[model samples]
Target: MPEVPRTADPFTAADLVLLNGTVRTMDRAGTTRTALAARGGRVLAVDDDAAVRGLIGPRTRVLDLQGRCAVPGFIETHNHPTFFGLTLAADVDAGSPPNATIADIVARVEQAAADAEPGTWVRGYRYDDTLLADDRHPTRADLDPVSRDRPVCLQHVSGHFCVLNTAGLRLLGIDRNTPDPVGGAIHRDAAGEPDGVLAETAAFAAHAAMPKPETADLAEAIGLAGDAYLAAGVTTVHDTGLGLVGGPAELDAYRLARRKGRLRNRVRAYLVQDLFPGLSGGELSPVEAGVAGLGDDLFRVAGVKLWADGSLQGLTGCVSEGYACAPDKNGLLIFPQDDLSRRVATLHEAGWQVAIHGNGDGAIQAILEAYAKLGLDPLEGDRRHRIEHCQMVSERQLDQMAAAGILASFFIKHVYYWGDRHRDRFLGPERARRIDPLASAVKHGVTFGLHSDTPVVPVPPLEGIWCAVRRTTRDGHELGPEQAVDVDTALRGYTSQAAHLGFEEREKGSLEPGKLADIAVLSADPGAVAPDAVRALQVDATVIGGEVVWGGAGLDAAPAAGPAAGGGDGR
Candidate 1:
C-alpha cells in the first residue's frame, strides 16, 4: 500500500496543532510519529514539535499533549446504535451488582413504572440469565404490580431476545393462537400459553410497538451514544444494523445528528436488509443518496447488513456440530441458505458492499459459499464484504475467506467473556479453540477487524484490542495464548483495519495526510504496557476530526446504563 500525502500542505496554515505526544498513526507499515497539524478537520501535517509549530498561525489552536500516547480514533464494526441510544434515553441503570436478580429487576421496573405517566412505557435492559436466582424469565405476574395500565419490556443481555410482560404481549395481541413468526420463537409453557420469552424478530417486534423516538430525541440519543464512544477513545463506529424498523427512523436519527454537528466521530451505518422492503430484486440506488455517505467527514453509510444466524446465548447460533449443552440441536438459521444467498447476490450485484452476520461454523461456511458463488474478482477496490462476528469458523472456511477476499469482523471479546461458559455448556472445550480464530485469519491473509458488540458488551475498542492480544478466558486461564496477537497487530485491528472494513480507510483510521483528524490520547503507551495491563489502560482524551469530543480530566468514569454494561469481563 502506497502512503497518501497527509495534506496539500500539512506543515503550512492549519486550524490546530497537537504537539508533544506519541502519535501512533497505525499507517500501512505500522509506524508511530509525533506532532500532528490539522486544518478543517483533516490531518495536514505530522512531524516534530518545532517543525509542526511552523504550521501554527495566529488563528491556530495549539494543544500540548504533554507526552501522552495517541492513536488513530477507534472504529467499532458491530453495534446497535438506535437501540443503544433509546436505552440511554430511558435513563435506568442496569449494571447493578452482579448479585442483582430477577426480584431486584422487578423492583426496578416497578419504580420506573411509578415514575412514568399512565400509558407511557417503562423499559429496562441488561438482564443476565445466569444471575437470576429463579433461573427463569420474569413474566407479567412479576411486573403486574409495576403497572397494568402501562406496558413494560425488558431486553435480555443478548439483543436477539427479550421477555415482555403480559401487558406488552396483550398490547401486541400475541396470544396462545398467535403462531410463531417466520424467523422467531415465542417461548411457551406446558400449558401452551406465552411464557414471555420472545426470541429473534419476535422479541424485536414487542419493543417495536413502543413509540419510536422523535427525530430530535433520536438526535440527542445519537449524541449521547457518540459521546460515550468518544469517551472510550472510539473515533468511528460501524453501526452493524441500521434502519431496523424503516429507513425514515434511523436515517432521521443519523441525519439529525450530522445536521446538528453533534456527531464528532464518523459512523458507517450499515442499513439493515429488513428495511429495503418491496424492492424488485434489481440494481438499487443508494438507500437515500444525500445522507447515505453524508456529513462533515463524520458519518457515512458504509454498506448493507444481514444476519445469517442466531446468537450464542440464545442457543440459536448455527453450528456445524450440535451444541455441547444441547446435544440433539445444531442451532437455528436466521435466514436459510437459499434466501441468504439471494440477498447477498442481489446486494453485491447492485454494487452495494455486504456484511453478513455469521457466528457459528456452519453460518460462516454458508457466508463463504455465498461470496464464492458471486464469482466476483478480488482485485476490485471497495468490494470489501465483511462477516460480522465470525465466531466459530472452521479451517476450511478460513481458507475460503482468504480465497474469496472476504473481510472478517471477529467478535473476539466473546472468547474472554463467554469462553468458560461456552466451553462447558455450548461448544465443547476441544472446539472452543476454533472460536474467533484471529491467528488463523492472519495466517490465511484475511484482514480481520476487532469489535465489542456494544449492548452485547460495551463499545470499547481497547477491550476488543485487549481480547485479541491476550486470548485468555475470564477465569485467568489461557485458552490459546498461541493465537494471541502482539499489541501492534491488535491495535491495527481496532483502527486502520476497522476503517478498511467500512471502506473509510482513505478518510479516517490512520493519521496520515488528508485523513480525518480523528485521534485519541491515551493515559499510557499501549506498546510499553505489560500484556496483562492492556485492559487497565485509560483514555486521557478523544479528538475526532480536529475537535475534542471528550477531555478526560475529572471525567465521570461510571459505567453507561443498559444491559450491554462495561467492565473488565476479562477483555
Candidate 2:
C-alpha cells in the first residue's frame, strides 16, 4: 500500500463534503468514517463529522446522506462496450424473457426484416438455446422464413455462436465448400451442407462481415452504454474488446464520445489482438508503437486482449473432460497451443498486459503453458498478466497462477444465471460446483476480481457481489456453498481487486485521502444487510472525480451556512 499524499496546508478548504453517512473507506483495515471531504477531485479527509466539518468552506457542496452508506465505486474488470452498445441500438432482443422459443425468435427476426429496408440485414442477439422452449439452436431453415431476400443473423447469448439465414450465410460468402477457419467450426448437416451455425472464429468472421455503424451512431451507443454503467454505479470499466465493431473506427468512436462529453466512466481499453496483424510480423504494430498507458485518465490503451477458448454455456470452451450433456464432445481451443504461445510472447515482450479469455480448464492449462514457455516471471516485477473469465479453473491451476502472480477476473455471475444447467448438463455436479471457486482461489492466494461480462449478463456489480457471496442458482439452489466468499471479500472483488486488475489500485479503488473521489452512495450498507438482500440495495448517487454524475439532483448545491450548521449524528 502507498502512503496517502497530503497538501501542505492542513486545513485546505474542501470543494465537496458529505455528512451524516457511513463512509466505508475500503482501506487495508476496512476502516469506516462518519464524514468525508474532497478537494481538486481527490479525497481530502475522512473522519468524524465535527473533524471533517472544519475543512468545509462556504463554496463547498455538502450532501446530507442521512443514514445512507457510501463505498468505493464499482470497477468492471471485463466488458464489451462497443458490442453492448451496438446490440442495444440496432440488434433485436432474442433473450429468454422476450422470446421463449425458436419460433418466437424467428418471429422477432421476421418483424425486424419487415421493418428494415430491402437488402438491409436483420440482427438479433442474446438468444440462449438452452433457455429456449425448443431446447436447441435455431437453424438456417428456421430463420429462412424470416427472409429469403433479406439476411438474418441471430447471436447466441454467449457471443461465441450464431445462426444465420441462407442469405446471411451467403452475405458472408460461406457455403459447403468453405472450410472452417483454424480454431473455429462451421456446423454441417447430414447432407454435407453448411447448417448456418458458426462457432468461435467463424462467428467472429460473420460479425466482422456486417456493416459498421456510423461513427456518430457508434458514439451515441457508447454514450448510452456509459449512462447504463454509471446508473449501475460503475466508475471504471475495462473494455476487454476494443476492435469488436470496426477496428480503428471503433477507436475513433471512443474519441468522438469523449469529445462530445458523452463518456461517463473511466475506460481501460484492451485491443483485440487479431485486429493488428503486425503483432506477429517483424515490425511493431500500431498499438505497440505507443506505450502501455497511452491515453488520459478517461481512456487508455492498457493491454492486448486474446482468447484461448469460447464460452462454457455455448459448449465451445475447451474442457479437459467432455461436457456431461455431450459425452464425445470436448470443446475446441480457439488457438493452437504454439500459436497462442507466440501471441502471448509477442504482446508480453512488447510491454503490454496480455489478458486471455479462458473459460475451461483445458484453455487455462494452455495459457499457463504459454506463459511457462516464455519463462515469464511476475516475481521479478508486477506483470499483472491476467486470465479473463477463468470459469473452470482447477485447484492445480489456481496454485500455478498464484505462483506466477497471474491474476484472474472471474465471471462470478454465471452461478446465478446458468448454474443449474451447468451443474446438471454441462460439467456434472462435481465440476460445476467448482465453477469460479472463489474460496479456493483465496486459499491458494491468487489475486482475483469479479466481473459480469455484461451484455452477456446485465451490468450490476451488486448482483455480481451477491452471486459471489451466495453461490445460488436461478432455481434457488446453492451450487457451491463451500466456494461462497464473505461480504467483504465479495465487495473487494468489485472494488480494490478489480482496480488491481487494471493496475489502477493506487489511483482509485479505496477512498483514501489521496485517491480519486469515486464513490457510490447506496441506500443501505451491503455488509449490514442480509447476504441475500445485497443486490436489492439501491444506488442513491454516484460521484466521480468529486462530481455527482448521476442521481444527485438538489444535493449538488452548497450548504446555506456551513457544514457545522447542518450536521447529523454521523449515522
Candidate 3:
C-alpha cells in the first residue's frame, strides 16, 4: 500500500482544509471523512471534523462544504481534448434539439460559412441521424447550399463518419478514380462517383487535409475544453487519439498551453500509432515526442494508440458475426492480422502501454490475441495495456481478459446514447443486452473501466454514471438491466478505476492524503441516493489541488435541495 500524509503543527497549517462535508475517499475500504487538508498540490490530511479544525491556521482557506458530498474528481479515461476544444470552439452544435433535422444542419453550416474566413472550411459536428427529423445522414447536395466555394465537413455523431461537400472532396482530391483505403470506405453514388460520405480512415484523411489551427488557437481550444471539463468536475483526462495533434507543431501546442498556464487539469496522452516510423513494425523515438512526449505531473504521454476497427454505431466496428441491422456486413478491420500483431508486439516489447480502439468482437479478439502473444499480464505487474471501447466482448473473452490481466475501458455511455439503436438496429436484443457488460466483467474479475468517449457523447460525468447504473437509453428503455452496476462501482468507473486506466492510480484517483487534492463537490452523496437519482446530483463545485477551479459552494448559485427521500444507494 502507498503512504498517506498527516498534519504536522497548527503553526504550519495546511494551505486549505475542506471540513464539515460528507466526503467519500473512494478507497478500496470505502473510508469516509468529514474533513481534509492540503499543503502543496498533494493532500495533507484526512481527519475528523474536530481534529481537522484544530489544525486550521490563520493562513488556511477553509471551506465548510455545508454538508455537501465530496468525492475524488472524475478521471476521464477516454477523451479527445483537441477535438473537443476545436468542435466546441468552431463547429456547429447539431447534437441538440432545434438542430435535429437536415435542414437545420444545413442552416447552421451556412451560418458558420458566412462567419468563417472566406475559402476556409465550414465545420460542424455531432449530428445524430437517429435523432434527426429526417432520420438520415446529410449529403453533398444538402451541404452545397451551406457553402459552394468553402469546404464543408459535418462530423457524424459516432465520430467515425463524416459528410463532405463537393468542394471539400475536390480539396482532398477524392473522386471516382480514388480507390477506397483498406478498412475504410468513400461512399459512392450509383454512378460510381464519390458521394462525399467518408467512413473510418477515409474520414480521417479528410480531417488531416483541413487547414491546421494556429498554436495559440489550438491553445485556446485546449483552454476552452479544460474549462468545460473542470466545470463538469473532471480533474484529469486521458486524451486519446494524439494523431489529431499530428505534427511537432501540434504536439508543442500542448506544452505551450501548459507553459502559458492554460492547462487547469492533468492530461495523459497517447500518441497515434502512425506517428512512429515504420511500415511492418516500428518504435516511437523520444525525439519525435518534442517536449510533451516526456512528462511531469500535469501532462504526459502514457502510450501509443492504435485503431483496430471503427465504431459499432457506424457499422464499421470489426465483428465475428454479421450485424443485426445490416445483414451483409460484419464490420471491418483496419490492419492485417499479421501487421497488427507485429505492431502490438513491437510496442509491448518497448515496454509502453498501448491503447487500442476496438468496438466489435473481431477487433477485441485481435487486440486480445496481440497482448496474449506477448505473454503480458497486468495483474502480475503493471502492464496496463487497454482495449478502448470493448463494447462487444464475449463471456469467454472476459475470463481470458482477467487471466491475462487485460483492461477494458468500456464506452458505458453507449447505453444512454445508442442503447436503443443497438437494440432495435445494430446488435439486436440478445447481443445488445451485453453492451458494456460491467457486471459480467466484475464477475470474471476483469479490471474494467467506463468512459464517455467525449465529443462522441458530451462529457457529462453524472450522466455517464446514470447510464452505467440505470442502463437506460435516451427513450427510457432498459437495454441491459442485468449489466447495470451499483452506484459505488459506477462512481469508481469515473474515479479510481479511471486512474488505473491511465496508470495514474497512485497519484490522482482516490482522495488519499498523498494523492493530488482533486475533489468534486456534489449536492448529495451518490452512495446515499437510489441508483436512478444519481444523475440528478448536481455538481456544486470542483477543487483541483485545493484551488477552486469551478463552481464553489458559495461562489456559484446555491445548490438545490439535497438527495430526496426516495432513492437510496445504501447497499
Candidate 4:
C-alpha cells in the first residue's frame, strides 16, 4: 500500500479504517474496492476487508460503512473564496429571497437598516437581472422612500455587478463626475445621470467605499465557508479567483485562516492578476517562486487568475453571437486584449499557472489568442493551464485548448440553472443545444473539469455532475441529450480531473495505496444509481485526511426525506 518512495513526510499516521464500503476509488481504470485504511492523511492500504484490516491498529478508528459508498472529495474548479467570505461577513442576502421583487427588496433593506444603527449600511446579493420583475436594475429612486438613512447595495448574481441606492451612491462619492475606471462600467440613463447599476469595476468601486471587514471577522468568514463546504462533502476547493478583489486584506484573511487552524479543506488559490500590480501590469519577476505554493496542504497559492469576460445569464459574457435577450450587445471585455495578453505572458514567463475566466465562445477565443501571444511552451510533467468557465466553446477554441494542453473546466451547472433561459432567450434552440460542449471536448481529448460558480450557483460538485449527467434544467427539460455524460465521467470530472488541475493527482483523487485519504461516504453508489436519482443521493459522512469531519449517524437529520425537494450532496 505504501509503495511510492519519497523524502517528503507522509500526511500523518494511519488511525482510521473504512471497511465494508463500496469505495468508488476513481482509480486509473475506475476500480472499486471494499476497504481502505488511512494513516497520517494518506491512504495506507486499499483492498478487500482482510487486506485493509491488516493495516489497521488498535488505535484505528474503524468506520462501518453499512454498505454505503465512498468517493474522492469534490474539488470546485472556479470560485471566489475571499469574496464569498465577504458575502458571508455582510449582513445582506439578496439572493436568498427568491420571490422578492423591488418592493420586497426595499422593505428588507428598510428592516435591516432599522435593525442596525443609523450609519451602518445594508448590503444584499444574488440578484438575477434577468428575473427582475422590472427586467431592469432598481435605482436609488426605488429605494429612497424605503430607507434614506443608510446606504444599500445589492450585488448581482455574477458578483461582477451591483445596484446601489442614492444613499449608497452619495456615501461612495460617486457622482456624475466620478468617471468610470478602466475595465469597469458605470451604467447611465438617457440623461447621462447614474442609473444606480454599476457594471464590473463600477460595482467593485461601490464595494471599495464600504468599511473593510475586521481581520477577526474576515477569518471567521473564511471559517464559515470552509465549514459549509466540508459539510457538503468537499475536501478541496479551487479558490478560482482569490486575491482578485478585497486587496491585500483578503490575502491576509486566507493567511490568517491557515495561521489560526481555521482552514479544514485544502485550497489551491489562484491570485487575481489585478491583486498584484507587479504581476498584473508590471514586468515579471522570478522572485515569486519563493512565495509560490506557500503554506501547507491547508492552503497554497498555485497560480494567477484573470477575468476575461463576464457571465452568460447577465448578457456580459463575451459571446460569439449576441445575447438572445440583448441582441445588440456582444458582452463586455473585462480586460483589453493587449493588457491581458501582456499580463498572461508575464505571469507565464515567471513560471506561474494562468487561469482565465472565459465563459463565452468569443471570450475563449480571445483568451486563446492572448495565451498564444505569450508564446510560452507547455512544460513537461503536470503543467495544466486552465480556462475557468469554458461554458460556450467553439470547435476551434477546443482545438486551441487541446493544442496548448490547456484544461477547460466547464460550468456544467449552466445546463441545469441557465439552460432554459439560454434555450428560450439567449442562444436559441440551435446554438443552445451545443452550449457547454462537454462531450465534444471529451471527444477531442481535451482535459476538462466541471464546476459550480458558488454564490453564482451553490458550491457543490455533485450538483455540477447532476447537471452534466442529466443535461437537465430546473424545468426537468434535457437541454442537449448528446452533451450528457454517464455518471462515471461526471464523477471523474470532479475527482480525478480536479486533482490533476491541482497537481495532486499523484497523491489524491483516487483511492490508491499511496494517495491521500480524502473521501466521502454517501448513502448510495452514484455509479449504480439511475441517472435521475443521482441528484437525490445523500451524503452520510465525509472523511478528509482520514478523519471523519462531518455527519455520520446525525446524517439522518439531513433534509433528504422531507416534503421539501431533496437533492444529492453535490459532488
In order, the Cα lDDT scores of the candidates are 0.75, 0.86, 0.81, 0.76
Q: Return the candidate ranking by lDDT, descending.
A: 2, 3, 4, 1
Better of 2 and 3 by lDDT: 2
Which candidate has the top score in TM-score? 2
TM-scores of all candidate predictions against the true structure: 0.90, 0.95, 0.93, 0.91
Compared with the true structure, model 2 gives a TM-score of 0.95
The local distance difference test score of model 3 is 0.81
Cα lDDT for residue 487, candidate 3: 88
Candidate 4 regions exceeding 4 Å error are 1-14, 284-289, 376-382, 554-571
Candidate 2: how many backbone clashes? 0
Cα RMSD, each candidate:
7.3, 4.4, 6.2, 6.5
lDDT of candidate 1 over 1-571, digit per residue (tens): 1111122232456766677778888888776777888887899887887677677554455566666788888888888776677667763444334436677887778788889888766777767675467766677677777667778888777777787778888888999999987668898978999978898878767656667667788778788887788778887888888876334687787877878977666777888875665322533546432234454455666678888788876787888889998888877777667777887887776667889998988888888777887885677654889899999887788788887788999999998888877878788888887688888888888898898887777787777788888888878777767678889989988888887887777887788988888888887778988988888888877877776667744321222233221122111
Better of 1 and 2 by lDDT: 2
The count of residue-pair clashes in candidate 1 stands at 5
- Angstrom error of the Cα, residue 235, model 1: value is 1.5
Candidate 1 residues lying further than 4 Å off, grouped into runs, are: 1-11, 91-99, 245-247, 279-296, 380-382, 552-571
Provide the lowest-lDDT 10-residue window in model 4: 1-10
TM-score of 1: 0.90
lDDT of 4 by residue, 413-446 (tens): 8887778889998878877888888888888878
